[model samples]
Target: MTQMTRSAVGGRLSDDKRKAIALQALARTESIRVLAERNGVSGPTVKMKTCMSRG
Candidate 1:
């Protein structure tokens, strides 16, 4: 599998923050675009977090 590198955004999201984002993403409770925008992360980053949660 390919390594997943984080984006060079303003700063890194804390572990708790990442978990929170991943939870909401995996739960399918909100739109990915909205979540990414609100969290200041790229859409792909959100998807990557959810994918990482799989393992």
Candidate 2:
């Protein structure tokens, strides 16, 4: 599992926000690094978002 921060992606992103990010990641509109940077999180967290959405 990727290391998750307590307030990664801007002071704890909401479920909906995570979903949006996941969707974007899945759609290939945003790279994990880009999303992570934009969201103030780590690259693995972006990957986790897409993975967890499928799980």
Which candidate has the highest TM-score of all?
1
Off by over 4 Å in 1: 1-6
Residue pairs in candidate 2 whose N, alpha carbon or C atoms collide under 3 angstroms: none
Tens-digit lDDT track of model 2 for 1-55: 1345534434478899889888989999867888777777777677888899998
Best by lDDT: 1
Against the true structure, candidate 1 reaches a TM-score of 0.79
Q: What is the lDDT of residue 19 in candidate 1?
A: 85
What lDDT would each prediction earn against the true structure? 0.78, 0.75
